[model samples]
Target: MHLPNGIFMLQRVQTVYMIVAMLCIGALYLWFPSVEDAAGIAVIERSEPLVFGLIFASIALAVISILTYKKRQLQFVLNRLNIILNFVLLGVFVYRSLTLSGETLVSEKGIGVLLPIISIVFLVLANKAIKRDEDLVKSVDRLR
Candidate 1:
């Protein structure tokens, strides 16, 4: 079983953070007026909560994978979900980046645009660890 170290013990807390972060992002998007620029980047500024929430979710998952004693199958399912989420996020960024042309650079910076890639990397690593844990479990079962 993976050891409960680092932030693994904070799953519930992290989830709460995630929910709140998503809400804040939604709110900011709703409040922001459409960019009036016609020839440059439309700065796509993001509320801080949205940024932190995403990073928090990634950290939470990493911690959960290390701390939980759940069966490998469930962990694998969670990892897959993370992967899907990452892809969706990446898609959003790609679309946004492509469309940002012909407008004033959006309020958001490149770091936010780059976050999906980082999250995807962490999710992949977490998934790999999950697989290793499964293998270890199988070996132990065979010993019995």
Candidate 2:
């Protein structure tokens, strides 16, 4: 299959950052339970519909951002949207963690709860790189 010229090229740093962010979210599906009960049952796992949807949506956005490499401005905008979506996901995790009783059913909050923050950091870095690329292109155009 003949792919487009620039699509899927790993030449840019932003693409790597975005892929890492996507992987971080995807990792939640493995063994990272968001919350566990005293009985060792997963109180909140990636299988939960809401959590699943949010995670999938974030991943989709990252993929789309990566694919739109030719349009730097659009790619940058998509990254911003992805960042906002991650913030919403983080908010949901925080709210859920806060609502669960700490002493009783809520035994421990898993490291999965921090995945959104990690994803957000990568997204921010990706955006910075995208912006830098855009500025470089603009400066080149100015020289002409």
Candidate 3:
């Protein structure tokens, strides 16, 4: 029932959740197209500099978080930071979708718009798992 140092991290549920969240973010980069103009060209394309920056930043954070699994406290903090970043991304999506000067800003709502929500859900699950593991460790310490 006892796993050696680094091996224990591989068995943690939170790691799986983080990986899933990363996959969702990657999907956002590959398949989620943003707003379209009158002629049907995408205005805020996912490949645009600003959009790419936000997406890559999120991906990097998630990757760093996964690699920091040994430090539960740091992992928890990173997950929280990632969640906040996802919220900001979601806010941007909302802003882009809303009407501006009596004209709808977004001509199409793609799966990319929902990526943040999906990523948030996965991150929350990861955090919950991490908390559970921490509680278990604390209780074990009290027993000794």
Candidate 4:
């Protein structure tokens, strides 16, 4: 089946990214790990300002991305900005994983590997979508 010009491919990857983001936010709800389990995270989490800044920035970015996807007339700036912002958020996650108090970097768990891998995949797909969008615009301009 042919995808329409404006449609986003690799949406499933974005869905997965979004799902993981949700899971991370819900992490606090799922279980408050013991201080011992917290590793370095407790120390990090307590610096309330930095953690809140990260949370709000991520939320704003997610909202912007969603709004960009929904608009019929795409703004090129938003398209590029969205990709950069997603990468920034990905960096935030990487920082959280690395600097949290308890542990060495690169846990043995398979799922931990998936997060950055997933972010990178979606970043590529989102750029592809933006390129497709610009190409479509060029085609339309040619027709005119």
Candidate 5:
């Protein structure tokens, strides 16, 4: 599809950041292992409703933000929401790992816990870029 002149989503730095953050969240679903049961089998699968819902929400937010690039304020708002979601995801990971019965030590926690943190960082960067662009627009508007 031909994007109109300068409106291509991929042309924006924040869009790239958002896409990366989404990918990281996706990776978290696939790579991160859930708490293991007494039989040593992972209790939660990526397909689990709760886990899948959060991941889907995160990816959807990123995509919606990217599509709303023409509306900088809306994009910024969406990015902020996405960051909050990532924080929630991280908290869930922490709570799950810590509350597991009889499980101790840091090594048992899967690398999945870090994915939300990574997603948060990238979302923050995207928000910063969006803010920068918004500032530039406002300054230019003032000059007119």
Candidate 6:
């Protein structure tokens, strides 16, 4: 389908993937308590500056990548950066969960902690689609 500027095609698979990744990252905001103590006190949450910045950055990257659909290489690179950012966020979650008192049981962890993994998965899928598009373009150029 055509866009106003003749760019930003919504029919692209990578665009859909990036949008899903953005939504996954955005979902963390809905899960207030990223971690809770045995007594149910919130230990870490999306409101924390570090966590907020990381999530916001991830979402921003997804949006940028989606908008840059015409530039497949840039979109791929942005997805890679987003994946790395998600990894850092995951590490932060793991570290926080591990440091909690009394062995960090699964019950103490919140759904928010898993959002990064989901986002990362979508980002990887988007990157793969972008790479495929890039390769297709290259083959077409070669055939010229």
Clashes of each: 17, 0, 0, 4, 0, 0
Q: Write the per-residue lDDT of candidate 5 for residues 2-107, one digit (tens) a residue.
A: 7685466687899899989999998887776755555656655566787778888999999899888789999888989989888887777677666766554333
* Count of clashing pairs, candidate 5: 0
Say what the RMSD of model 4 is: 7.1
Residue 114 lDDT (model 3): 86
The lDDT per prediction is 0.50, 0.86, 0.81, 0.46, 0.81, 0.84
Candidate 6 residue lDDT tens string, 1-144: 555963548878889888898998888876546788777778775578888899889999999988887788888889999999999999999898888766545447788888899999998988888888888999999999
**Top model number, lDDT:** 2
Q: Please give the range of 10 consecutive residues that has the lowest summed lDDT in model 6.
A: 100-109
Instruction: Look at candidate 6 and give me any clashing residue pairs.
Output: none
What C-alpha lDDT does candidate 2 achieve relative to the native structure? 0.86
Q: For residues 47-101, could you state the per-residue lDDT of candidate 2 as single tens digits?
A: 7788888888999999999988888889888988889988888888888877876
Q: For candidate 3, give the lDDT.
A: 0.81
Candidate 3: the clashing residue pairs are: none
In candidate 6, which residue ranges exceed 4 Å CA deviation?
1-8, 102-107
Model 4 per-residue lDDT tens digits across residues 1-144: 988643563263443354354344334223432122223333333235654454455445544554455452353354355455446644654665566553643333223324434544554565565567668878999999
Ranking by TM-score: 2, 6, 5, 3, 1, 4
Clashing pairs in 5: none
The list of candidate 2 runs beyond 4 A from truth reads 1-4
Q: Which segments of model 1 are wrong by more than 4 Å?
A: 1-42, 45-68, 101-109
Models 1 onward score TM values of 0.54, 0.90, 0.84, 0.47, 0.85, 0.88
Can you write out model 1's per-residue Cα lDDT over 1-144, one digit (the tens) per residue?
Answer: 778454453454433333343333343244432232333344444433544354445445544543443555765665566557556655655665567664443334434455555555555665666577678788999999
